[model samples]
Target: MTEQAAAVVDETTVAADLVTQLEYDRYTHEDPVPDWRPAKPFAAMVGALLLQELEDASDGWLHRTLDADPELAANLGFEPDNPPSRSAISRAWSGRLAELCSTIETSARQIRQLAAERGSPIGGPYETNASEEPTGSSKRTVNRLLRRKARDLLDELQTVVLPAFELDRPDDLVYDDEELLTLEACLGVTGTAANGGAETYGDFVNPDPALDDPFYEDGPSGETPLEAIKDLSPTDIAKMVNQGAARVLTRAKPRLEFETPVMLSIDITYVAFYGEREELVRVQGAPEDKSYDWCYKFATANVVGDNVHFAAGMLPVGHADYHDSDAYPGKDKSYRVGDVVRRLVDHVNDVCRIRIRRLYADREFYATDVFSTLEQREIFYVIPARRDDRVKRFIARMNEDVDGNKQVTVKHDNAVYGPVKHGGTKSSTETTLVSLPPDEDRKEPQVFATNLDVNDEIGLDRRWAKKQINRYSRRGGIETAYSKIKEFAPWTTSTNFSIRLFHFGFAVLLYDLWLLVDFLVQTLIDVVEVRTKPRVTAPRFRAFLRREVSALL
Candidate 1:
């Protein structure tokens, strides 16, 4: 402790001195110091804590004191009679301040214990043999604190999602909306499917047998949440879940530190369905031997980079419900791949409040309409090209046996292509295409379509093209993210689109939280080398959440 830290010992000079000591601790620490600037002054929080300690008041005393008196708030260094919001105060205390307070108090008590042991008798003879133990929430491990804060942040999603479906907590409800939402996240983190997992968790937490039934099971006789969810339309459910994802992006945007505009990746994922194909269900093509062909498809837009792959927006990809006779009964209602990209881009831009600089996608997004959409938005992108006749002709022009391994690079700056819709008009886009030599990953040549500068004056700009191609390779993170998203997604056999959509969306939310935690942990350990590798693995985070939330129950 320095002189500034020593000044915090006296109760009369506590709050301001405590702030000084905090500043001292930050400045004197090694590299990678915590980057936190509280919204409220630390002095006000410190003074409130000290006041509660002196008066032996309950947890509600801080807010009550600030609300009942203004003079004291001003004296404690809050903006004249304008105390911080209850949430702000709670956030401030729940963060690093709590650790600092614990440290300071413990250090002072240890000093007193040392004095008593040495026969100095400071503070009127402290007992050396007395056990010093933390009680209640303060006794929780660091993992518990982290899980509590994460779940608290995710609770905001419920406030946005539930009302979108016109849901509220009824007295006779089997589980409150928050509990169901947390249960959804719990199922996702634990990699268990819905009903069985819910029943197991309920058995541990719910003491009353009547209320311990799985509330997510699909049935007419049960009063589970699925009963209410089954009433919502597919559009309503999609909108509600997307709103929840947008809220997550809005919350995560502030934590990102970027030197360039964010890079985004858009791709579609399929969830296999075994039951009968109902409304909102689309047929996914597969081999004749495969059992399940019908599936629910969802498109997600994710930020793709070193340590920041958050699924920012998501939507279902299916044709409009026109009639029971034919899938194409309604021409105008079907959502195309281009429409998915445009909606996700606009939604992410509006909600995240950040300009998207580049977008990357797999060959499935190699259509002319997709290229035209990205170009129109002026967002640079790289999409692996489908080997159509024109693309194959360009690849055939290259020497077959160049450099003994048939590895030769080719670039075409002006290539025109179009899409043939189902009995609809075709549209074309003029873009650049790059054909690369085979490498260790694959034996065949890889072609990519992009608006990036990949041209060399005489031949392929090997260096520049290689650098851009390496950036395109970062899109692999999106696939890895999808695999991990599945890890967080609960196994569900339900064919109801609403339940499936909610489960997938909530799993994405948990995945984003897991990435956020890893990024934060990296910032504390090594500020520069972030997202290089995960500091907190998925299993560890899931375990933490499961233990903490179960303990809460």
Candidate 2:
């Protein structure tokens, strides 16, 4: 037989075998299968391939490559007569994209754990064994399966793949016992407390030693009851305080108990981006007053306590002069800050059956309605009074009496005094200026207003009034929590889409969870890596990758 004729016969036989295999695969599956079930897995395989190369090639190029490669086309279950439509590929993504994200989050968590255990010089000392472990099994499984697929194809694409395309193993693959405990702490489930037991007592734990030292502390010269512990991990600090508070309440077993108050800080910031300089008219008649302009406003709020939270709620802007302006209706829409605050308050109240003694807010919460509502609920509140003419006059009067000394302290009863000014065009009301006592450096009098009247000479003492000021001053703690939310969570960024709101919320929750993990890791590090002082930065990512790789291995 001629060589050409023999080759043709062999090719025919190979083609026949391929056809037989295809038919068997399609027919053997009895599921209410898509007409393409046997071939469907092939589509998933190709989709994964596209994802791997997505960064480099255009979509068209990828499609063409798939078309040209015979083995790939067959593996994708593409028949000679029928090819997968672009829409089909696109549609498939919707079904699997979530799985991909879940995979990534899981991988990140696992890798962090592994890195903490092996790479960290810090020995594992912390651990958390909960009755119910946080559930992420489905996500982890999906990530593991996809990662395995990637590994199997590694050798085939080694030469073509760029170095950047290679995934790096996370540094936090292994977590010591301490790291595990930290994770628990961040999750708000670190230590177990006996419910209403004899051992439990209600007392705030003074974790920070600095709180005892007056000089080092930021506030007044007395030892503040709240201890300021430095160098402790945020997660650990939060957990320890919460757990201690919980235990204390359990022991007290009081008829009325109060849940620990979670503080959320809200702030507004504006950022402006300009491509080039733009001129603005200063006045219609004065050309000399013209100036160039570039500016915009971006307002955001950070709600932090055990977990970081955020909202894109509206903030009202109103002008006293323009009460009828059309812009006021839309631009000055009411925000839901009060609603959120109420919900938080309710949560605590329901859990502990104890009323929140007071909500501390800065001048922003000085709105009469807000104060009135809290008062109606029998909730005490300490909010800074807006510094209007009344406050200024009181300060001026005190200064005059003291021979130019700015400090003075006094008490007054009932009648509102000071300047009458309209704030936000709402109403014309008088602001009462009550003087507080002189502090160390300045004898100048500080002024404030409150509805509560102090008739008793001792009750009106400046020291008592100053205490109110100090208590409200602690509201700044909310700002610190806000900073952490923006710094650590990606969702807080303005660019995040609303579709991902729930996911972002979940991510923040996970971050809180990671903080607990970090506390445990830090504890372990203290024990194991203390001398070497090894540090792990991206513990979550590290734990995730390590877990996936371990599974594959």
Candidate 3:
């Protein structure tokens, strides 16, 4: 080799000492590296990828950097004398699909075991010939598999899937461990807890050290994390994540404890963008602001029925196609909302094989398209009606029939409702508008529309429409899920939609995990006579997870 090339190779000698993430990626169905070819130090390759991530370098630039940059090569454990070729490094990344998948499964199983231990301690660690074998959770336990699904889906993104798309794995990523620890971090913040347990425990001996995090204090102090993460979001990663998460949830269906239909609550959370990247769409948040943020909106699909309250998927919103509603209800275009609901429902229904019992959305979602979609799907829904003259007339007529000094209620059985036409491209349909008398909290009477017939729907017992209207109030769980998810998310201000997407996705995953633990912990405590047992709080849970994560690094 020429002296110049030799000089370039000399700079990466540091790979000789450090260990790389390749080990975490390795699990034996027997080893694949043949002895005839000497093993190259992979740690340097790890360093190269890290540098590439932080710097968003082209492959050509990364090749040159690895050959010549001593600091970068050394940190990744490279031997400066023999750094890998660009082609060789590329091959290493592209061929790892099987290994990456294996790692995710392995990690997912570990999380399932940890969850089994909490509230339902199966036997401790199982030994080949020992007298005691680790026990599994009781067969009767509820939502156990769902808990596992949440962890598997959450961790797969950072560790297995994201790395494939980014050509690098998450630095310092933690997989589905600390079932109890996570319970403390996520549930501790929400202040929801149970008072008892199942008298079981899960324990492991000499657990592997957690993978190191290179983005935070755990990484080299000299590096800036934001600059390194630019290429992490490949074009199709978002769609993959959406499909993968649904797949995970779908797989858990056979293990479901009951046959009840699923209830989903969908809401769009508007996140403001502070960047000038031109794709930004205009979104108005809150009524008082003069100007809205150039923002990207995300739709959160959550399970809110049969007492389940975990988040499932978050779909990103694009430039919405809007048109004026018939007679101008002044509502935001309903077609976008309908389109999101239809797509999400079809996706989840295909995966989970469960019918939707009902859908609960906030008042802002009252677009003409939304109502038509719900009715067409035969999915019952309750959304605030546009408080137009027709709705007020319904309230006024109901009020006039009331006895003096007593407030009027929905006692009308054979009643008629004002019809409103709405939709775009798809033909318009009429929705029944029902007005609710105001309570102490909301002085203005609430007007809502629904397709539920009093005699036709199950559990529609109350002749007065209060019973149907009351179901919407039960949707508060999803609203609470949003607030707590934002609390659990790590702070980021990247203008890249992918980065923003990942941030939001990770937060949703964390929130779902906490809910699972919270549900198990709650059920364990809320039942029977053991209600005094201490419930883990959210703050304490956060601190517990933080300290545990730091220790892993």
Could you tell me every candidate's TM-score relative to the true structure?
A: 0.66, 0.35, 0.54
Can you tell me which runs of candidate 3 are displaced by over 4 Å?
A: 1-237, 247-259, 272-279, 282-295, 318-335, 402-427, 455-464, 524-535, 550-553
Locate the minimum summed-lDDT window of 10 residues in model 3.
194-203
Off by over 4 Å in 1: 1-175, 207-223, 275-281, 286-292, 321-334, 399-424, 458-460, 527-533, 550-553
Query: Scored by CA lDDT, what does every candidate get?
Result: 0.59, 0.32, 0.47
lDDT of 2 by residue, 46-103 (tens): 3333332321233344455555655656654566335455555555445534344353
| Cα RMSD (angstroms) for every candidate in the order listed | 14.2, 25.4, 18.7
Q: Candidate 2 — which residues are off by over 4 angstroms? A: 1-332, 336-344, 347-354, 399-460, 491-511, 514-553
User: Quick one: ranking by TM-score, best first?
Assistant: 1, 3, 2
Query: For candidate 2, which ten residues in a row score worst on lDDT?
Result: 196-205
* lDDT minimum window of 10 residues, candidate 1: 124-133
Candidate No. with top TM-score: 1
Question: How well does candidate 1 match the true structure in TM-score terms?
Answer: 0.66
Which one wins by lDDT: 1 or 2? 1
